[model samples]
Target: MLDIAKTAQLTPDLLRSFLVAADTGSFTRTASLVHKTQAAVSMQMKKLEEDLQCLLFKRDGRGVSLTAEGEILYRYSAKILELHDEALTAVSGPKLHGKVRLGAPDDYAMKHLPGILREFSVNHPQVQVDVFCDDTPNLSKMLDNGQLDLVIATDNVKTKFSAPLELTWILPERMDPSGLKELPLALFHPVCCYRENGLKALEKASRKYRIAYGSPSLAGLLAAVQGGLAIAVVTKDTTAKGCRHALPSDGLPPIKSVYIDLRFKPRNRSEVVSVLGGFIAKGLGIVI
Candidate 1:
């Protein structure tokens, strides 16, 4: 049996060193970052290997690469560091005092996010929130530029890192598709998940459809649909408020909603992001 006491005694500093080594692909560079001698870094790594009884790295031509065990340990180390950072920030701050610029796509912003934000605001009364309603691609760009701290957007473009949610189709109420060959549709602008999914579904089924109306805002799309223009596809949670599902009858395709986060920058504001993200996840019943 493994020594429970020894496992419990593993330190965060050692984990941090392990991650730094994995990231830089060199014990020397990792030692420089951690202000330790190269020999000391190598010793720590050897000690870690002994404790775990696994080879964490293998020396290549001139550098080192992670073994399979090393790769797994790196992933866990990153999560540990992330959680540690969040905990430190939560206790270090005066209730997140800052203007947190947040952005969301119009559909979700209107339908689902309000309740989550409401609960967040009640909990952190000191935070000043500035929200922008826009398309997913634009919102993602803003997040990359640090113009916004958090964003809730549909999965249109692929990010190196992201959290995804499943999406569904919504159609007109009590509509029959007995003789329908094509669908008259309302869609959001480009790079929106609903728009992409709708188009893909039609193409995959070889169905012909026309853009009856296109809108940048959810309100505009809903207005056009309600005015007897066409049907729109949206997240299940967003559409459950008013619209009904239309698939299997019209042969429309099904889609999923994906939530993505820009992890390019490691900021001191991650705790706030995590708290708000948790609210969103719980509200949507998905872990993105």
Candidate 2:
């Protein structure tokens, strides 16, 4: 048991080497990052696999790549390192004291993110937040341009990381099913994930539909829905009051909400990125 604990303690350093190696695709680069020799890094990785009883990396003429176990370990190691940094930040106050420009879809900003932003602000009062509410593509562009430090947008453009949400179609309470065939759809602008899914499902099912209304803002969309203009697809948590779900009748596909973050280079890279990433994970209910 004592030996097991000792081995477990070494696992993090092993993971560190593995992550660096995978990123650089070279044990030499990993060795430089860890201040160790290439042989030392290789030995640590070998001991890691021995301790876990699993192969974590595959090496060949094409260069080294992560095995299945290595991919899993890398994902968890990133999270572990994130939490470890968060702990250090909590103990070492004011590490991230600067303006943080964040972007989110209007719906998330209006409905799902207030409590999260409030909590984040309370925890780090020294950090000032400026928020932009926009469509996913616009936010992605802003993130790419470094105009935004962090963004919370529906997954449309591919990014290195994303968090998932469960999406559902919502309608006015006690709405009649007889009008299902001629259902009016509420939608955002083109390129929105929810709108795309909703339209695809309708088309796939051959359900006759028309756009009764559209809005880039959640408040406008909900207001339109409340007034019996149309039904809309949105995340389960983001649904407003006075609305009920409109489940697919037969062959329509279900939709999933994926929240993707753009990787931005930060001025205070470690501290700012750490807090922003942690806040995002906690907001999305991802277990750190």
Candidate 3:
């Protein structure tokens, strides 16, 4: 039998490495992230498995995936690290302090910013983050003009980090497309990709459409959709209660997937901005 107390002692170092490996699904990437060699990382994981007396990872063609035991460990590891960081911060004081200007589309802000900003505020209460919500083009302009430190953009060409977003057509649940003479659109500004893609798709399909409502705010668009005023384009993960997804069979043409991209101002690449950018990337599951 194994010595329970001795074998079960999990050091923060091992747990941190394990978390990084699990999150990234590659020892090579994890090594780069944690500043260790690939061989050292492999040895650490082997030791971790030996200590735990269970298989934590399974090899695949691409990289590695967590076994059931590893999944459990991953969950626990995140909480463990969170608590560890909280304890250290409580004692050592907030190490990072400065202001960061962040910009994102209103929809992205509604979907992703809350949890990320909440955790960031907890960790660096001294850091003041001024957030601006705008369309991707405007945000890009702001970043290039040195008016913003970091920006999250949708369907952007240039990116420091990025994640895929599946596009979809959203409309009132009970509204029938065939009954209407022309499809009405609720969209953002003319420069927005969602509006552009949606319009291009409609035109290619030879479908008649009119801009029924226009709004920069996600809420306004959703309200227009829910109120049955117009159909709107949104990401698949949008969960407006009264809205149903429109299919290609419903005479709506398909919109190609786009990326949620992170961008940084070259001149404003301060430590605080970097920290915030890293936090946003981690939150969005994008590796920097």
Candidate 4:
């Protein structure tokens, strides 16, 4: 006879935390991603390990990495969560049926939007998510003009829904910026946060730099950077394969942190719009 009382059951919360930890390879980062304290995340992982009666993580100086058992669990955890969400939607209520006009910068649309949209579609299969890619200033204008139901913008002072984003200096793998007296840069237009912040940082640091290439498109700027025409300041997520970060030893000025802001019209906002907005914010771990 089996002792059912002694068996440990896996819960969605624990699996979610574990999945984040595995993906990030850091409990601290996982804590931030899941909106929990580091200690709380640690406790959850400990409980999960105890429940499974197996070691799932190997801790080292850099961070934690998954063990063999952890790898196995990660695969199943993702499927389980997917099915979990699917099951809830199937029984919860009538599926939401509407259209959500979403706008984002091209960079974010490529780097971050896909997974979030995929999850959203799973929950609300009938809802149509229309994505428009443009610069932040243009996206904000569209949102204000009621051309878009929701938008993700680079944060400014008045932003209410925001999340932290890290910026990095991206340079071609074979090129070094330190050797040049006047640093060459591939930058966006004046309205862009990357352009404004990067130039400001270089000026404040008394570094001489010139706009070697300028474009309104992320693809064009990345091409310039990848071709070693110039370095660029961009969000950490969008660094290309042939590029590397400008390290402290590279003698480049540090870029400041920025925020991803979510915007929506306050008046006459439909329930579906609000739902999509909340979903995006939550997906990005933005605090309302």
Candidate 5:
């Protein structure tokens, strides 16, 4: 016989955590994405499995993987969560009126957010969104100062990183990384994650480097790289039209990709923030 009582107790929060863990394939990452502790995530998974009466995950040193039952749950959780979110948004009314302050890098603001925001606006025409486009560091500072409600920024901290975008080296397809006296780099402010990581890696490798082009605008960085002015460090998710693979065949030391993260400030006490967070996760199908 089925334990209908146990099954009935499954909550949306647990389902959301499970979804995040499934998407990231790591409990630690799942916690970061859901704003929970690692222990809390583990306990939630344990409780969820107990309720369903099945082992849902397999854990090893590499990370966690789903059991066959887990695969089934993952599929259903996505659909169930989507429906749940839809119900909430529906009840909340399409004429949801509120102002949402959002910040993101120029590249993402240009390429990625438009479709998501357009869809959001279509659903909630009364909601107003003011977006700021700038480098991650500056945007992060604004978020900290409570001038922004939500921010998507490049993150160097592995623990706090959550965004799915891959940060990589974007250089001219024709340029070579070898035999240069000082590696020329087109980058954002030194406070930026990509610039910081790239420089640290190069210095640790004892390679000479120079900032060949510096700009706060992604357009400037793309222009410099496309014109063959210099090699730039940028997110691969925002891969410009004229660029080659990162450090292709140059035998340079491997550079790690910086994590892009969505962060909410403590002062952002708005129900719309929660609603939009759900929208970004469900509507855009991002783990966030």
Candidate 6:
């Protein structure tokens, strides 16, 4: 047990290190996140473990995992850090100022990002926000070209570092199925993951299909869908209010889960970007 006196002395910095370690499961990655050497992160954990009077990590040559006690600490650490950040923002005033270029897909920008950006703006009123909408591959290219500061990229299942969302097929609610011989598609360009998966599923099912509509803009896809143009595959979040989806019995194949990667140069020195990243992770209920 971590003694009450020792627990009271735990610093936000130490807890942050532990969190980075737990999220990434790598001391090197955690070190990069905290702007310290791998050795410094290790030292902080060692000091933290001593204070807690328990083994928090299962150390091996490869990496670390939370012990039973560490898992408990990790949960409490998240809440503590969240509250601490909120308090700090309240006390520090709206001092952070700068423009941040944030990129995401049209669907996410519409369905999810508004709340995230809105909350961030309420807390940091001095910062300016610039939003860019595009698919993941193009967004990745833009990020690589230094055209964007940060991006929420919908990566394929092969993406290494993040948890993926499950994909599904979407269509108008109560769409009639018995009359159709050929499936129609209203989707993004060939570079889009949902488009590719949706097409492949139809092909594997031996169903005939035609592209009724194609657009780079997600709004176009949704509009075409609303007008009874065609069916499309998208994340559950992106599905419209009156739309329904294809189930396994409908003959659509299962889509591979997609990872949403937060793209940025870790070494970049910008407090606003760092702060925005924290807000994004917190908003999405995911640790980056």
Q: Give me the candidate number with maximum TM-score.
A: 4
- Candidate 3 minimal-lDDT segment of 10 residues: 156-165
lDDT by residue (tens digit), candidate 6, 172-258:
766654357887888888988777777777788777889999998777887877777688877754545456677655665677666
Q: Report the C-alpha lDDT of model 5 over 105-196, residue by residue, as the tens digit.
A: 88767655654674566467678889999877788789888889988766766434264446677777687878777888898887777778
Error of 6 at 15 (Å): 32
Q: Write the per-residue lDDT of candidate 3 for residues 40-143, one digit (tens) a residue.
A: 99999998898889999998643678999999999998898778878878898998999999999988786677657756876797899999998888888998
Ranking by lDDT: 3, 4, 6, 5, 2, 1
> Candidate 1's error at 172, in angstroms?
2.1
Model 6: ten consecutive residues of lowest lDDT: 155-164
Which residue pairs of candidate 2 clash?
none
| Clash count, candidate 6 | 1
Instruction: Tell me the tens digit of each residue's lDDT in model 1 across 64-128.
Output: 88999999989888788667656655776546655667787776665555546645654665667
4 or 5: which has the higher lDDT?
Answer: 4
Q: What is the TM-score of each predicted model, taking all chains together?
A: 0.58, 0.61, 0.67, 0.70, 0.62, 0.64
Query: Candidate 2 — which residues are off by over 4 angstroms?
Result: 1-95, 156-159, 247-253, 256-263, 266-270, 286-288
TM-score of 5: 0.62
Give every collision pair in model 6: 164-258
Q: Which ranges in model 1 have alpha carbons more than 4 Å from their true place?
A: 1-94, 156-164, 240-242, 256-264, 268-274, 285-288
Give the winner by TM-score: 4 or 5: 4
Error of 4 at 106 (Å): 0.7
Which ten residues in a row are the worst by lDDT in model 1? 235-244
Each candidate: RMSD: 16.5, 14.9, 9.4, 5.3, 10.5, 12.6
Stretches of candidate 4 exceeding 4 Å from the true structure: 1-94, 156-158
lDDT of each: 0.68, 0.70, 0.82, 0.82, 0.74, 0.75
